[model samples]
Target: MPPPPPSVAGGGRCILSFAALRDRCFSHRFLAAGLRPLAVQLPVGGREDPHTTVHMWVPASPPRNPLLLLHGFGASATWQWYPYLRPLIAAGFDPIVPDLLFFGNSCTRLPDRSDIFQARSIKAAMDAIGVTRFGLVGVSYGGFVGYRMAEMYPDAVEKVAMVCAGVCLEEKDLAEGLFPVAGVEEAAALLVPRRPDEVRRLVRLTFVRPPLIMPSCFLWDYIKVMGSDHMLEKTELLYALISGRQLSTLPKLSQKTLIVWGEQDKVFPMELAHRLKRHLEGNSRLVVINNAGHAVNLEKPQEVCKSIIEFFQEPAYEASNEEKV
Candidate 1:
């Protein structure tokens, strides 16, 4: 029989278990406020549904072309790809930023394990939005999604880019420093920050390099609506990747691919970029940003944007070869 449940702080109404609550506190310590509600989704699951929190941001005057932007782990779509979206729009490209289901504000309180579900939901969202052929860009965790997308639907993606993405966890130990939890209990224990100051401190250490100050009221607001209270979902996703059990599958990526990495990034690191470059089956290029960490898109937006633009504008080799002949 299941062991007697521990005392729940918010009464039986709270769907989260004691272990879930503990893990949420521990794991959520690094998630920043500016990156909540990754995007919006349709009315699919009820309050209990797992894919509720996914959202999308469409820029004004969306060009005939559309660019999809996926965010990093535990970050909202807007926060993760903010640099690219605005500039991409200004440059006459339609940019779409969608928060994956579990992380941001698409909905709260998903089942303890929902990465696969999130992936399917994201695909559904793209279909719903009528995204046919478009460029795909993913940062960090989002890069994993982009890689999978390129692998799964090679014909659909015009180009692919991974910015400081965490891929190949099974083949390598890139994510060694991302999560600090030793076990399930230790994971849950990080969900609740004792005070707002603690939250800020954790954010600075894990996410922001120079530390972007969030308003005090905003911190309190985030704590109130805090979803993703269970850390295991994320852990399970990582475990699946690390164990080589589950990740977006790519047989032979034919799309043009660009990989970007922050030279100083500790999470995925420069080696990850190198390894991914070696693995991709399509034409690919690598760009390393100096003095930047995992959040290069945010820390050095212009540089990142410049790289993207140059990549996009550079004519495909086939096109150039045909012209030359």
Candidate 2:
């Protein structure tokens, strides 16, 4: 086999950074789709002493009903939501894709790592950008934040679409064999992988059928670019998610909720999706995409986007009638 492509020289060393090239390509895609990058600084507790900065992709002229796309634990907003933007735009929706705190350029100096904090920060970002009433589509960890946004500000959040988010997961779910991993620590390690093997494990768990022979160098490069940042804080966020909450105690959201799950998701299984639907009582709809796993949006973007557009476009009265039926 031939040697790898020429390494890009940076910081006085040769580095093969596919992620850097991918990020440039993602940015170009966003530009081509008519979305511009915007960064806003949100005050903590309405004070400027310490603030959180959020990075987002916004339209030049906002649409009447804006949609916010929140990314999961893996790559940033661009990599996760770029595929859905054009479809949403064509369907008469303005989509704002924001990198959740610690994912892209978004970060907070505050000690809080819960989804509540993330929700508030995102809300502040939207408010800064003059988006008061908008819909939300969140996948995986982002679904957790989107759920909190809907719960905390029901009127402000119009419609919610969650993809493979285990918001109803309790601390006990680990020992009960709900997840492929044994416990929180193991789960964290896999989710925030620092090694090539761990990245492979994550890929296996995330997709129904991942690449069978991912090169070790490629995995290492991915971890170096994507998985290296905010490692400690991300682990804290995971712990905080389950530490103070239980499925029974989770609040029932009032907004019309759409839960999209991969049929073969091992991370947050189909059982969780059904339970989430029932948990939301009469306010939720569940869509299970066949032959997909945790990263359904990436694996089956067309199906996921179609379900989202249909759900969001359905009239309120018709939705109510369907629910009744």
Candidate 3:
């Protein structure tokens, strides 16, 4: 809870990072929903990633039917996962929401930024928390990490739900005009916005209908608080993500999978969702939310939450290769 970064302190004006206060409010809501904050140290990471700190919002009581919620690349999980926490808890699943490395209170001295590494970090944190097996749901960037977790630790990961993750994307997709952005540099800039306009552009791309008015001051406050830290590391993560990725190389998960997408998603597009379904293991199913864009979870929280709950409640998919709104 400090003033905005130096970038926003010009003109001798006083500005505070409102995002901190917002996070505090979210924390209280989480506490009210029977969850508390816990920071776990990751020592399993080799020399470069020693003692990486991963902060998690976990159940105060022992978790029953635990579900790990991984957030997107930009904001903290507290902001993104706040809406679903109460509902998930009420549905008899302990929602273990964790801030991915470089977001919120999670950080590391390590240079590694691959989704595989991120998956490993989160797994180590789960191990420390005494969770042997759990369901996992990841959104956007978190979906990528969740996929890796399911692939790497099939025994520990019972099921997976991914929101707007471009799992079918290949390195050549960008060059072949798959995304609105020309290339990785532009993609990274919007994903990790530094300027107010970049933040607006990101919103426009992520949402089907963005807010009518977003003040410059507030956007600057958001950048300083939510996006100013570990910028280089985050950019590197994007590059590392798309470097040599291909559908053939991407491992299909053995666990049951749920792929959710915004019907009007500009970020990953609906085409990718169908492609993911056709290519991923036959046990997977896809759900498309109408009138929603890339940020489907935020725009269609109730629908997304309902789908997740129903999917997890069942032991296995009743039908395979399904796509429903």
Q: All candidates' lDDT scores?
A: 0.57, 0.82, 0.84
Query: lDDT tens string, model 3, 48-126?
Result: 3445899999988878789999998777887888889878888889999999998888988877889999999999999
Residue 268 miss distance in model 2 (angstroms):
0.3
RMSD of 2: 4.9
lDDT tens per residue, model 1, 155-265: 777888778875744332323443344433333333334345645654553343543545444444344444333344655655544454322453446787778888777
lDDT of 1 at 173: 38
Off by over 4 Å in 3: 1-17, 45-51, 321-323
Q: What is the lDDT, from 0 to 100, of the residue 245 in candidate 2? A: 63
The best candidate in terms of lDDT: 3
Please identify which of the two predictions, 2 or 3, would achieve the higher lDDT against the true structure: 3
Please give each candidate's TM-score: 0.67, 0.92, 0.92
Q: Supply the global lDDT for candidate 1.
A: 0.57
In model 1, the worst 10-residue window by lDDT is 1-10
